[model samples]
Target: MKKTLSLVAILAAGTSQAAGFQVDTHSARATGAGGAATAWLEDSSSIYYNVANMVGVKKLDITLGDTGILPSITFQRPNMEAEGQRTTLSPPPHLFVVYKPFEKAAFGVGVFTPYGARSRWEEGFSGRFRGYESSLATYYINPSFAYELHPRFRFGAGLDIARATIELTRGLDFVNSEGSVHLGGADWGSGFNIGVQAKLLDNLDMGLHYRSAIDIAFQGQADFQNIPVEFQSRLTDQKAHADVVLPSTVTAGLAYRPLNNLLLAFDASWVDWSTFSELAIRFENPSIDNPLPKRWRAKWKYSLGGEYGVTDALQVRLGFTYDPSPSPNNTLTPDLPDANRFKVSVGAGYQFKPFRADLGYQFVALADKESTAPGMPGTYSGNAHVLGLTLGFNLQ
Candidate 1:
């Protein structure tokens, strides 16, 4: 119970977004294909999707990409007029490099943004007491190795080094007046990822991948403002500590090529979000703890995509995905209002000798949800757009 509360305090605001703030837009190829590239290895960037597929890459390759995510949310109370909308745009970069020094072995490195979120609400809003400004960010660096065990089977493993940071602000009331409290923290953690790829038939490929969870303990200071003079001593800048576990994931996928120039793929993944049940922040001054509740559940996501070679130098891609939210209704807050999402994606790629460039765009439609959580009461609706571009070079 004690550990659970600490975990909740550190991760509740971080993981309350779409599928608990787990961003999957790692590569343009994957993004264009609705993140269904697990079993379809087309470029060196597959190191992050399925490292085992590296056994099929024969040259030194490097890819650089970035994703622009724009999100909007609107809220409405029963009788009051609709509130103004909140919008924010986030851009994260990705890089991957692969080298094959032997016929049966390969090595690769990847730097990607797997999770992040930001939310800001106007002051004096209806839900101001719930939260005002919040943000969470993470970066991962992975070094992986792959080996071909047989003509049709390959295995891979990698170690992940990640750094994360978080900031949260909320309104508080004292003596019939309004005030605010702010908290900030950062940490570094380690984990591992593993994968396997197999050719089930002459034209069918299958893959399985898993990433272990990383645990981070955060230590920082809590700052308060506008508090009455009486409680200033105990509410001012104080030391705080909390901990959270970044959940793991398991993915399975299959790719089939029915023609020489056309390929189709599908993937399904399960995320462990139940680890976050409660969150507690311990303060140094009064030695008191503030615990928040978040009964999140596991979530599943599904994606399908197809690629067609228009000519020797160009390829067209189309994809779709269904992503469900894991946020429990009782814990829903204004700072992280999220719902199920349906996404559509399209992209194209051009290859010129050793250089290739790819571009993709995804549109997300979020379902409207009604929440009657203790302090916050409203209906929330939102949408998102994601744009990605990747440039790669082949150095053989």
Candidate 2:
């Protein structure tokens, strides 16, 4: 029973791997530019990257988009190898609306998925005892307000409302064969975000954005199945609860335009993942409570992107990003295998009067990592392909 409860803790803790689960493809324009749209302006997605930049929108703007992520992950140990199945086609969609009520103030709302993950391993994999199937999804709704504090500066803040769901399934060693345990839960959380944008020079702009951490309390049930009649009474189904903290992040960016037809942008971000050092799960049966330790570290991410205007209504963009993993080897788990990654992206956009359409594609390559964590020791390798599309309409 203790071991079964421990798997629950691992599932909850593993879901917070921002480096592996974070969804950065909020906008096709930004995704194509390697998610480097902090200071650059021209779209309603500003409500997400840097709300202060909402001042760049016209009288009224509406943007809608979605990104499809397909990931391939594999694990190997000695002579045995296993592949993770493709679980989802698209996690969620993004929608942003910005309205300028007056010349100096702008109000906007953004709906998007910031964190999500889904993975499934083969039926007879060696690590099935730890975890074989897992999924986590979070949705965020932000209503923001921006004000022009100065002719060249603007500031904004938003209220963040989030909802999250988690599910995990793993096998239980019962001496002869294996029984399975499935746990599912859902919860709600709240946080805040703030940002500032400034025109530093005639052709240069700078922006900074911050998103606060959110604590969620999940309550659900755990179900055990296929257990032997002898142990069925001891491993009965019961309710479970866990509290998790989503990390905070800060990003700073700069955009430079050297020519009328070219725009370049760079962004750096810091994630405070150290908050997830430990986790505790309380069950309906107090005797089976379990506590787990996960000493994750903070990480930094950097990106660079450029866009060139090819014609009056056409633009092309290219971008690159370097993201490092925060999870140390000692705490790594099979549920979420993470590693440093490099991402390259390309995109194009065309405008026809009040309507604009953008298409972006990104390829993620994860560096192979060897893990020697306690009982599970193996080599993990994976990569992902992401495609995004966004449409914008200027109502004014």
Candidate 3:
């Protein structure tokens, strides 16, 4: 039982879906203009976007910011259906510091909601057979430093001290009983992050970053109340154990400004979902047909955004992104409810001396995807929509 719960949490795929466990945490000033801040990062937000850029400074700098993700989901199929619904507010906030304690070098530290998110469904959703209710959350604090080998080459590294929690529930076998069974519990782990940025030419810049995967091996207790009395008594151990393998990923991209005040950026990233197979747990031995038999494949996602300086203090940004699904239809699980997605975003920012404000909006359309397990009766279709907001400020 413990193993099953742990698998559910580690395998809870959608926890950070902008890219597996990635939400692009940064200042709205950066995101407001579609991450064009790569080369133009003359602000304190550089602590997260690109620490090396802090070399632009001559004074002490500080930044504080926050963003929100509001997602809506829906389920449909020949045999089952549910109304579209929106998730609760996922508020992510960040703080950054850059101290030019010495010339040609910058020292910094920050606390932010770097990676994590969760989803929830009503008790009677159609895909209950695969997963009923799901919940996950994570927080990170990083103490970092960076140096400028020269005006064009900058590098940075940091340790990610993270805390996470997971909760899961799935429908029980009707032939077996009533209501859904809780299949997961909360657990925590830690990891690291390393990244670099380069200015090869006057108008071109590149960035590379890597995030290590964290394994949440959880231990807990569980029991099945709906099962027949005989089976319940025989399974009295109640101890649960599971090893959840999340994957490490890499991202590389470029930023270019075509016109005097127009900036362009493109980023391509890889997420290794292949690490997930059948989320197995052990009793005396592993169950042949664990309610969820998932096989997610590795995939890549890319984004292109542009920023235009409307005026010295205000700028407008717009962009589009396409992401392929990691899970095949046959292996999809309600817990992950993932699909290929298309997103469109627009935002603007205004800077007034030492203060700045950013506002943005986005719309996401999900492809119609399905999931069907052999013993799980029928197939189900899935879909969803999402909108987000970002706000930021920097001061000396």
lDDT of each: 0.79, 0.79, 0.61
Clashes of 3: 6
- lDDT by residue for model 2 (1-396), tens: 111123233553222223745777888888878889988764678878998988888699999998887777677775675655544454458999999989999999999988777677766777787677877778899999999999899999999999988888878898887899888998899999999999999999999999998787888898989999988877789998877777788999999999999999999998877776654557788776655565667889999999999998999999999988777877676765777778999999999979999999988887877777887777777777789999999877
Clashes of 1: 5
All candidates' TM-scores?
A: 0.94, 0.94, 0.84
Which residue window of length 10 is worst by lDDT in model 3? 377-386
- Residue 297, model 2, lDDT: 78
Model 1 lDDT tens row, 10-127? 3333222245688888788778888898887746777678888877777788899998888777778788776644566778789999899999998999998777777776557777
- Superposed on all Cα atoms, model 1 deviates from the true structure by an RMSD in Å of 2.2
- Tell me the TM-score of model 3: 0.84
**lDDT, candidate 1, residue 146?**
92
Instruction: Give the least accurate 10-residue stretch of model 1, judged by summed lDDT.
Output: 7-16
Better of 1 and 3 by lDDT: 1
Candidate 3 lDDT, 171-259, residue by residue in tens: 65556566444544556667776667888778888877676766767655555456566555444435566766556667677888778
